[model samples]
Target: MKKFKKLFAATVISLAMLVAAGCGDQPTNEDQGDADNGGGDEVVTETPGDVGDAEITLEFWNGFTGPDGEDIAKIIAEFNNLHEGEIAIRTQTMPWDNFYDQYRTVVTAGEAPDIAIMHLDSIAGYARYDLLTPLDDLAADIGLEDDDFIPEVWDAGVYEGHRYGIPLDVHPLTLFYNVDLLEAAGYSEPPTTYDELVEMSLAVQEATDGDAWGIAMPVFWPSNMIFYSSLMSHGGDSVSEDGLTPLYNTEIGYEALQKMVDLVYEHEVSPSDVQADGEVTLFRQGNSAFHINGIWMIAGFEQQDGLNFAAAPVPTFGDQEAVWAGSHNFVLPKQNDEDPERLEASMKFIQFVSENSLQWAKAGQVPATYSVLESDEFKALEHQYNASQQNFVFPPSTPFYGDAWGPTGPAVDEAMLGQLTPQEALERAAREGEENARDAAEN
Candidate 1:
C-alpha cells in the first residue's frame, strides 16, 4: 500500500504565517448565533436573489475523477440551471493526491476555491492549518440540522467545537458474493457470521475442486480497512480520545489481524500472493466466491458483463457488527477577504446538493442526509442501502491522523505475507504510530 504522507512542516508553517498575516479572527459559535443550541436552531432561509441582485460565480473544487464524477457533473449542471442568472458554480476536478498537494499551495497564495470537498478524517488536519472556514452559521442559515443527517457523519464534520464540513455521502465496505458460485456450493444465502463464512468458504472451495477459490484476500489496498473493521468489531479503537496515542497493539488487535492472515495460511481459502485489486479482478472473472470491497465498486461491477453478484452488509468477523466507512463533505476554504455573498451562495449550493443527493446515490454512495436515506428512491438501491446498514466506524478526528496510521498498512502487509507474526506486526505498528502522533503534536 502507498503510504499517505503528511504535508511538509515548512509548507504548513508558511501557510499558517500567511493566514495570520492576511485573515482576521474567524467567527466563533457564539458569533454565529446560539452557542448552546445545536445545529439549525437559528434558521435564516434565503433565496437565490438574497446574494444581492448581481450574478455571481463560485469556484467549486473536488477530487471525484471516477464514475461518480459524471453523476456530480450532472447535479452541478442542474444546480447551475436552477439559479440561472442569479448564481453559477464553476467546478474544478482532479485526482485526490494532486488535490491535496495543490490545495495548500493555493491557500498559501490566496487562490483557494470558494468551496471544496474534504474527507471526514481530513477535516481536523486542514482546520488545524487554518485553511478552512467554520460553517456553523452557514449550516444554520441553510436549516441543516443534526436530526436530518446520519449521526456518525454529521458529528464527524466538527473539530474543536466548530463545524467545518457538510457531509455529502458515505461509502462503506461490504461483502460481495457470486450468486452462481454460492448456489453451486449448495448455499442459498450469504454468510452472516464468522463460522458461517468459514464453513461456506471451505464448502465452496471443496466443491469447486480447485477450479475457483472461496475468497481472494488482497495484501494491500483495502487490507487495512478490513483490519480496521475487525478491530472495531472486537471493541478496540485505533487511537486514544486525546488523539495523541496509539491503541491497537493489544490481544484484540492480534486476534483481529490473525483472522485475516489465517485466511491465506491456515484456512487456505484464499491465495497467498493476492496483490492490490487482485481480489476485485478475481471476483469479476467468477474466480472467487466472495470478495470484500467498498460500495463504490457497485457501478463498476454492474458494468462487468456476465458477472452474477450481490452485496450484503459486511458479515460479523468479530464480537460485534462494525464496518469501516468514510464520508465526503463540502467545505469552504478560507479566503483572503471573506465575501458574504459567496459564502451565502455556497451554503445555498450545499443545501441544494444535500436535499437532492438521491441523484448522487445513483453512483453507489449512501447519502448522509436522513431524508435521502429514508427515500423510496434510495431504498431502491438495494446493494448500497444494504451496505449502509452496518455500524459504521470512522477514524478519530485529529491533525495528522492518516499519517499516524500509515505504519499500519505495511505491518498488515508483512503479517499477511507471513514475514512476521500478527503480534509482532501490530506491536511494531503501535510503537511507530505513537512516534508519528508525538511528532505531529510537537510540530
Candidate 2:
C-alpha cells in the first residue's frame, strides 16, 4: 500500500540519518571513513564537532504540528551538524490527534523513541502505565538539577518521588483582552481581580447589547485548567494537600463555583444556546470581550486580523493570586532493556534544548529554565508580558489529577446557565468527582 511505502521510506531515511548522526561524533577525520558505512545522502547536524571517538544516537519524537515544530526541527538539525560523530538524533513529527496511540504502540512494542515531548497532565497518565523511563538516576548522573526550573513546572514530573520526565515549558492561564473592544465599551483598563472582572463583564455586555459575550472559556466535564484558575483564585482546593479526597465542596470551593455560575445566570452576560460551545472557538471569532488562555495562543492570534489585544496573567479572586498551569516535558522511553548508545546523545540533546530555550519561547510556551524565564528576551515576548507578575501557579500533580478537571468546570457552567442552582451543582460535582478519583486510584 502507499501508506506502507511512505512509512518504509521514512524509516529508511531515519536510518540514514542515524548513520550520519553517529559520524558527527567521530571527529571530522573519521567522517570520511564513516561515510562509507551507508547511504551518505542523509541530513546532518548544522554544526560540526570534534566527536571523533564518542557517539550517542537518540531517536526523538514529538507532536509539534504548530510553529513550535519548525523551530524545534531547526534546533535538532543544528545539533546534528555540530556534533557529528558524537551524537546523531533521529527526529519524527506526529500529528497531535493520533500521538498517544503511536507513542504507546512504539513504547510497548520495544521500538520506543529515545526521547519525546509530553504535557504535564499526560506524564502522570503514561507513568501510571509504565511506558516511561524514570530520569532520576540519569538526572543525577548528568547533574540535571530541577532547581533551575520553576518549582511547579519541575514538580509536575515528580510523581511518587521518582521523576518520569523533565519539565520543558509552563503554560498558565492569562487574560487576553481586545483593546478596541474595551475602548468601545468605555473601559481602558483590564480586570485585575474577581470584582473587577465582574464589573468589566457587565459593562462590556451592556455596551454590546448581548452582541458579544463578556468572556469565553471552556466549561465542561473534560476541561481541567479553566476551573482550576477560578477555584484557586477564590482560595479553593479541589483535593487535599495529600491528594486524598475532594475538598472543593467546602465554603471557598462552593463560593467560587457559585460566583462563576452567577456570571451567566445572575448577570446575564454568558450565552446559553449551545450544548458545547468551547471558548477557543468564541475567542478566535472575536465573540467575547475577555479570553482566558495561555500565552501559547500568541502565534495563532498574530496571524488573525481585526483585533487589538494584550495578554496578562490570570487575575486573583483572593488576597493571594494563582493561575492554573501545566508543562511540556522531555522524557526518555524505556528501551526494552537495550543499553543503546543513544542515552548520552539524549542527554546532549536535552541539555542543548534546555539551554537554548529562549528561542523556544517565541513559539508561544514558557521555557522551563529559570535563566531564560528571567532573561529580557523571553520576558519581553508579547505573549509572556506578564512573566514577572506574581503568583502564576500551576495546579497540584496527583495520580487522579485529570479527573479533577472537568469535575468542577461544568458544575460552574451549568449553574451559570440556571440549569441547576450553584449549591446543587457543587454537591453533585463533589460526589461525582470523589467517585471518579476513588475509581482511578483503585484501578
lDDT of 1: 0.75
Q: Looking at model 2, report the run of 10 residues with the lowest lDDT sum.
A: 6-15
How displaced is residue 248 in candidate 2, in Å? 1.7
- The digit string of per-residue lDDT tens for model 2 on 69-149 reads 667777776777788777776767655434556677677678898898866555655676677788887777777787787
Please give, for residues 346-398, the per-residue lDDT of candidate 1 as tens digits: 99999999999998998888898879988888889888887777787765566
The TM-scores, one per candidate, come to: 0.88, 0.80
Residue 12 error, candidate 1, Å = 22
- TM-score, model 1 to reference: 0.88
Model 2 spans with C-alpha error above 4 angstroms? 1-56, 206-211, 217-224, 241-244, 274-278, 285-287, 387-390, 404-406, 409-413
Q: Give the winner by TM-score.
A: 1
Let me know the TM-score candidate 2 reaches against the reference structure.
0.80
